[model samples]
Target: MSITARLLRYFAFFWILFLCAGTIYQYINFKHDTYFIHLKQTAVATGWYLPAFYCHIFGSSIILLAGFFQFSKTVYNNRPLHKALGKLYVFGVLFFAAPGAYVMTLFINRGGFVFASFFIQNTLWVIFTLSAFLLVKNGKIDAHVKMMHRSYALAFGAVMLRFYIWLFMRLGIGVDFENNYIIISFLSWVPNLILVELINRYNKCPYRTLQN
Candidate 1:
């Protein structure tokens, strides 16, 4: 493989591993932590919270796990399974995951900026997914693919959040971690979309092409 390809492969592997491990750690810790349990219980006391939590957790997990697969060019070219998975992914994000994220955002403790960042992310996530679905429905495959890529890039914030924390902690900066999280809430995805924009530019792929 070329050096760039090799670097990308290594990055992808490490990213996927770190994401899986960190999320598992967080979930396990959440299960044992009295604070999280109490918060969950409180959320459950309200009728919408429990369902939102479940959808957010399960749907996000599934999206993260399945998202990497969608990036494979080979899989995109494969008609049957690809379309089926794409439909399922869109449904999961739109009907369950994104809505759940919006509902859960009301309870975020990172104060206004962080909550607003996530609220925006959730909104954009739904828009990206819906746009991708509409493109495919209209037989615009390239637009569908690019839009779905943007959608998955937003979903990758969960992975990037932990990655940034690890970076700051390892750097031994004395800054307050909570403040760092506030920054990361937005930083995690803004650069992602920028990277996507660069890719589209380099590839000369218009966001939505019309070939009349």
Candidate 2:
């Protein structure tokens, strides 16, 4: 890896760890009203929201950590371990994380656009992840790798959403919280997927030529 790629890898690793740690600490008490939950008391009252919230939080955390290592040369060389982690990541997203996110989207009241953004994001997340699993099952390794990259790009949106929120706040770009959230809702995942596409193009990923 080039120095820049190495640096980005380290940065991403530490950033994910930091976010996961914060999420764990925030919900360690399992309280009904806490952090973001505190803002969604109405949603919490629905009885379904809290369970879905926990599912998304805990499930996404596992997949986030596991998926990050999916790109590691060391882990990739260890076929058994890589396959194990891939299974964990796929099942975690399909069964727990993505489904939970889908449920949560129904409760979003941040206007139709914001809701649309999240709904679309969750939908694509499932599609990409499922495609990755199916492609690998069919022994299409290159396509599987491409799809996995797309899947994790959306997965990383959880991190990017929070990062952008913090960044916007610090930069004083969007003072209105509601409008700011609306912007970040799309910003979080769109750029991630676009960047992944650009990277695949630069690397001449086989999936691109296959599509062409």
Residue range 85-114, candidate 1, lDDT tens digits: 777788889888888888888877768988
Model 1 residue 49 lDDT?
74
Local accuracy by lDDT, each model: 0.75, 0.87
Best by TM-score: 2
Off by more than 4 A, model 2: 174-178, 204-212
Q: Candidate 2 residues 26-48, lDDT tens each?
A: 89789766667888999998899
TM-scores for all predictions: 0.82, 0.92
The number of the candidate with the highest lDDT is 2
